[model samples]
Target: MAPTTPRPPTMRDVARTAGVSTATVSRYVNGLQRFTEATEARLREAIDQLGFTVDPVARSMITGRTHTVAVVILDIRNPHFTGIVKGANRKAQQLGYNLLFVDTGERQSAEAGMLRELSRRVDGLIVSSRMPDADLSTLRDLDKPVVFFGRASQVGVHSVSADGRSAAAMLGRHLIDLGHRRIAYLGYGAARWDAERKAGLTDALREAGLEPMFFSADSPTLEAGEKSVGEVLMGSARPDAVVCYNDMLALGFMKQAQAAGVRVPEQVSVAGFDDIPFARFSTPTLTTVDMQSEAMGELALERLIELIDGTLDASEEMLKPRLVLRQSTAAKVRT
Candidate 1:
């Protein structure tokens, strides 16, 4: 046969090339049709050669599945939340799901509505922050799967979190190991997680027959860290070391110490949790515990997928944290 100039392809063209019906080609493109490997490969190749394109909106109408998962996050500006988004987005793509990110911007009512609205369209959901007042009830009423990360839910809810308890323990033990007899924990002191972390710190202190000095902060802001640490340092006796709730707070405490003309390690030692990217770059760096943000996201996404597929039971899964020692921590020195 003489060489023939191939015509640009359409659904019919793809079907003819693949030796399948036009309807078959259409269904395959819309993901409404299942196919054998050979048939799928042939259709795929034909479409590629023809530069075939389908309107995703139309495809969604036909298939009834957008292949999208909505990820509702609180404050994308937070480094930790950003890390979870990164991991969840990558996994969503790997699993053939599109990401529809909704930032709550840290508003309770806004998050609640966005969550409910997103839940209606997405095949599943992954929420990064604590569910707002009605958010949990909404998730409970949702027909699709939902998984929470770093934030916990009700008794029956699914959550993936780093071992908050262990994180405190590691930091505490590290300080005790350095012969710091008196340590303090400073953070948003009343939160459930904060309490758990404090327990771990006290546990570590008890193991070494030491006592921990605690100064409760209203929040984890750097200002709070600075003020709290200042009070501790100004007390009758200064703690040999202090463990902060997170890197941000730790950095603040470190700054306060510097301004107060205290010699670090020689006068005071500081440890922090949540080894955010900035933790390693901080001045004098920081001795912190890594919450394994990416790993937490991965596990949360996996758990969401499982809940969607009905492959695994919804449950709380905790990943352990690791201690990161840097220039900021050293053996205690009596002033």
Candidate 2:
């Protein structure tokens, strides 16, 4: 004779054992309605005895809210992205939501796959994408509330970003005023945000009746910055000052400069973007732009909540950038 398996518990079994209507049990369990203390005690006792647990899939089906969000970042290793993720996670938890983060490793092709998979499991999305407008448009069409963290799109997606063009122009003007004419721009290939900063620098150079020597790094990395320094120093027009894409690149160039016995600010003044934490503590502290990345992340999460609740109206927000003066940059030395 084979032993029969024990019958699995159900909501009905809980309601029957507790001597309450199924509707009352359902409402009380889901927190949509309350019952008398006596009824609640009976239900809890029944649930304990039956070992009943609410299945998340069933709960989601009933409430129509997964209470989960997906955030896609370009590079998780970057401190700038770390700040954004921290802000977003804090804000999301306060709003009764959990975050699932994905790193694209700066790969454009990976974005589509991440979106396809995560969109099915999360209630909303927050992305700091480096993809083109055409490729990013697919995300807006996913029928899920989405908020862009850094870049804005023409597809009318909600976004939070810094005015990098103006910030870069300000940095460029500062260098120009400090008597730096033969300036070189060190950065990776074309990104809209990068393009904006480059345009600002180019316009500033044009206004000063000067031209820039452009050096393209393979990627936004310390190694790229180190390798690009050789190109900048060996070029026909040696730059008196250099503007790097971000702090890592700036530090890399500074490292190479030190090894080559080139004095910072004295021989080749250096500047960078994204005033990360170590920027202020680095040897000859890095002069860079503060993009308020954490605030951007918090704002994006707030906007995403509004979107989920159907209260959002504006499609975009632009945060301000500030220039931080540090020891890495100074008036060019006359040599």
Which pairs clash in the backbone of model 1? none
State the lDDT of candidate 2 residue by residue for 286-332, as single tens digits: 99999887887788888998998889864668999999889988898
Give Cα-based local distance difference scores for all models: 0.78, 0.84
Where is model 1 poorest over a 10-residue stretch in terms of lDDT?
128-137
* Tens-digit lDDT track of model 1 for 1-335: 99999765579988888899999998888766689999999999999988887766877788766778877776666677678778888888788778888887655646656667788787788876544334466666767788876454563568788888888998888888887887888866434467778899999999888878888776666777788766888889878788887777888889889888987767778888778898888778889888887777767777787787679776778888898999888987655
The residue ranges of model 1 lying beyond 4 angstroms of the native Cα positions read 1-10, 30-34, 131-135, 150-155, 190-192
**What's the true lDDT of residue 203 in model 1?**
93
Q: Highest lDDT among the candidates is held by which one? A: 2
Off by over 4 Å in 2: 1-58, 150-153
